[model samples]
Target: MDAYYNCLGCMNRQVRVLTMDGQQHEGTIVKVDRNNVYLKKESNGRVQTSAFYPGYGYGNQILTLSLFTLLAIALI
Candidate 1:
């Protein structure tokens, strides 16, 4: 979980997340754990309820990114 901590230090900051699959996501790191990294995207907010909003689209959203798939994370 050392690498997870590395990204853990980035909590609340905008970051670019790269995964092993070549997929990337840019958002603010909200929370992190041993298994996953949670994020609140710039386009999303608390006003938009997660119930109505889809998984990764605009509105209140929390992206649960699996740490196992993470390749690199960079503060933006």
Candidate 2:
């Protein structure tokens, strides 16, 4: 887990993270803590104009994953 602590320097950078269970997450690193890494998950859906706001798009969601569950992390 100490190795994952090095992710602190990757804050605000785009990354692709693979977990032990085979799940993959791609996003910008939002925050890294002692127990978890938070990612502002990128959305793959096509952009849609909001009904009320013509130019605004939906915001990406934040994902909280346990540092211990990570199998790999790569910068994209």
Candidate 3:
């Protein structure tokens, strides 16, 4: 099965991804291409505030995972 094609159908949707290294990431799919899948990672309810700038919410983070490294991608 082509991981890229599978991920293409999941764009802009929340999903849980498991990589070949056994790491799990839950996020909203931001982009999918031939080589990678970009995810807007969900925060675990812990606000990430920078010390340099107080009271600033960094917001959700984006992660880039290789398409070949993805072991599983499930809709949440």
Candidate 4:
């Protein structure tokens, strides 16, 4: 619940998420619910590789990160 409150304090902003696995994700949060945070991953990295399919994963991917897996989150 505290995490949800902390998240609400910074809604609709670009955040850099650091996971427990050491992966870093930068994206604008689209939604945050009870168990997960959904984000639209930035496309800048993929735009340089392929204009037609710039996103690294699939089309317009959204991240559903479990709060338990996150190590840190910062506004970028």
Candidate 5:
């Protein structure tokens, strides 16, 4: 649970998210799991939830951080 407090979404959030395709997005993480992370984004005056997978068998994909803790790290 501690790990969830410092995730990428929590830290450095002032900057928009840069996708692999060079797209920019603004959002905050609402939940995270071993397989994926759930994010909440503001779209057209509405909030939408999005899911992201960090790719399995990649490089150090399994991070030991909870949803909230990971957001904290992102903020730091």
Candidate 6:
């Protein structure tokens, strides 16, 4: 999906910035929009939320079609 909708909410407050190479940055999903996902890194074993952005930062993180299906199902 070029844009993410309700992904942060589907994430159930947990969000991770994923890299194409499978590397991931774990954080709490604070907000979501068409552009970027905002995540606040886990600090002191507690998570925080941040503002949203336009796109992924690490690299071109493309979500496979199957992943999209999974997300859709999850959202429902």
Per-model RMSD to reference: 5.4, 6.9, 6.0, 6.0, 10.8, 9.0
Model 3 — TM-score against the truth?
0.76
Instruction: Give lDDT tens digits, candidate 6, residues 1-76.
Output: 5436555445545554554455455654545555555455665865333332446454323232223322222221
TM-scores for every candidate against the unseen true structure: 0.74, 0.73, 0.76, 0.71, 0.39, 0.42
Any idea what lDDT model 2 has?
0.71
Writing each residue's lDDT as its tens digit, candidate 2 over 5-55 gives: 657867899988888999888877777778888777656763221122222
Could you give me the TM-score of model 1 versus the true structure?
A: 0.74
Ranking by TM-score: 3, 1, 2, 4, 6, 5
Q: What is the C-alpha lDDT of each candidate?
A: 0.76, 0.71, 0.76, 0.69, 0.41, 0.44
In what order do the candidates fall by lDDT, top score first? 3, 1, 2, 4, 6, 5
Off by over 4 Å in 1: 43-59
- For model 4, the superposed segments whose C-alpha errors exceed 4 Å read 45-60
TM-score of 4: 0.71
lDDT of 3 by residue, 1-76 (tens): 4899889999999999999999898877777778888777746764222122223235544577889999999999
Checking candidate 4 for backbone clashes, the offending pairs are none
Model 4: how far residue 40 lies from native, Å: 0.8
- The list of candidate 5 runs beyond 4 A from truth reads 1-15, 49-76
